[model samples]
Target: MGDDSIGGRLSEFIGNLGGFLRKFIFSVLSVGPIPNHIAFILDGNRRYAKKHNLKEGDGHRAGFVALLSMLKYCYELGVKYVTIYAFSIDNFNRRPDEVQYIMGLMHEKIEGMLKEESFVRSYGVRVHFLGDLKLLHQSVRIAAEKAMRVTANNTKFVLLICVAYTSTNETVHSVHQCFKEKRRPMDKFQEEEQQQQQQGLIKLVDLERNMYMALAPDPDILVRTSGETRLSNFLLWQTAFCYLYSPAKLWPEISLWNLVWSVLNFQRAYPYLLKTKMKRY
Candidate 1:
């Protein structure tokens, strides 16, 4: 046999072997306890598009398909709550054309979620939109509302989609609502100050009814794609102690195997984490 032929055969063999190993590892990782609520900062779509030399819209389309696959894996792993960072308020600063395209894509995906054949319906998933709804385009807002209304009755799993969202905005919104409920007149700063002083302390329960995620449990794990290490203003109040993982893959490249790996890593670290919590108590 020629040297070139032999080298080609060897490369194929190694590639196949690596693929098998990855599948085996993913299977093993999926067998253990899964988190009840997992959040994701779906990043790198634009970068993925650039690298692939595709249109900006194509990257988001690919990411949406990747998300569907991840949702299926989450259901299979018994995850009851999944929160995804679909769009950030910071995203609004992008080029107007790009942002418009993304908004259109968001509408399309939300509409798609309402289809009977959607994986969300098959898995009995309830959908919620968590964000500043007023900032979105009217069409996108309606699509999101429709998706939530249609899936409101599903009981198996909960999916929270964050669009036009920022942790700072969520916190400020909660505080604003809290004050509004007390009916403290904006003109009466002295009275409001006295009332706050009299209250003495603020607690999570006090803010519960004011926050957007009031009914949902805090996420147990938060995942970010494209190897980003920062929270990027996602779920700040709720993720006070959530485990965080940033895998090296872009949003469009995330797979079942990556999800499994993150879960397993969380499991390995959890016992130590519990011990630390117990010591504090």
Candidate 2:
């Protein structure tokens, strides 16, 4: 081993540099109170495209890339769950061509997940469509179902894609089921007979148990892009104690820094948030 050996020292140095970068990334994330679940309202895809003068659907394509990066960052930061408002039921009101384009994009992504070598496979991410899935196109729905089935056994991470989802609709649908199923919405002191007839009535747990997103826990952090202040009918029931972060960046421009800051901010508020949630519960 000569001191002047070019290959040995250079390769060793490159490996060291790579390790340092990886450690630096994880160390930066270690500063925060890592959230258990993070929900994203991925807005401004169309606006981002328009702003850049890109093609009509190009903004959405870019936004999808941003989503993949966001997921990787969250995993590294120890976030176990992620729910994204991928598509709203209101999106159906858009021009038919645009709506169709979004559905086609979803189909392509779902089909990609079926491959054993894809991101969904590599990351051991479980895919869940949390909404009125029947409203989706037949092809898209089939692909979504297949993705869920294939990833059902994965417990490493959960990704809930809110396609055709609206929080208002979720509430209404849950209420309707409560009555239809003849659930007793009463306390323990009120009625013994009703309890005998049914396990319970319209309790908070009842509604939650019946929600489309019942399997996932409440989100600890909710992120909305494009500087949006309101929830826009996303995760109304599940966000009772969530720390909501609204960033000026559009969905297409969301970066690692944005996610890092979001987690840091959640850490800052976790104490107050936990106190408030405990009181509420």
How do the residues 1-281 of candidate 2 rate in per-residue lDDT, one tens digit apiece?
A: 78679888999999789657756876876776678999999899999989999987999999999999889778767789999998999999999999999999999988988888877899999989888889999999999998999999998889999988999999988888777666435566656767676645577777887888888889999999999999989888889899999999999899877887887788888899999999987
Provide the global lDDT of candidate 1 against the true structure: 0.85
**Candidate 2 off by > 4 Å:** 1-23, 183-193, 196-200
With candidate 2 superimposed using the best TM-score fit, by how many Å does residue 173's alpha carbon deviate from the native? 1.8
By summed lDDT, which 10 consecutive residues of candidate 1 come out lowest?
197-206
* Highest lDDT model number: 2
CA lDDT of each prediction against the hidden true structure: 0.85, 0.87
Per-residue alpha-carbon lDDT of candidate 1 for residues 1-281, written as tens digits (9 for 90 to 100): 99999999999999789667756765676566568889999999999999999988899999988999888778767788999998899999999999999999888878888788888788899999999998999999998888888888899999998989999999899988876755545456767776777653455566877788875877878999999999999898888666889999999999877887788877887777557656744
Tell me how many clashing residue pairs each candidate has.
0, 3
Q: Provide TM-scores for the models.
A: 0.82, 0.87
Candidate 2 CA-lDDT value? 0.87
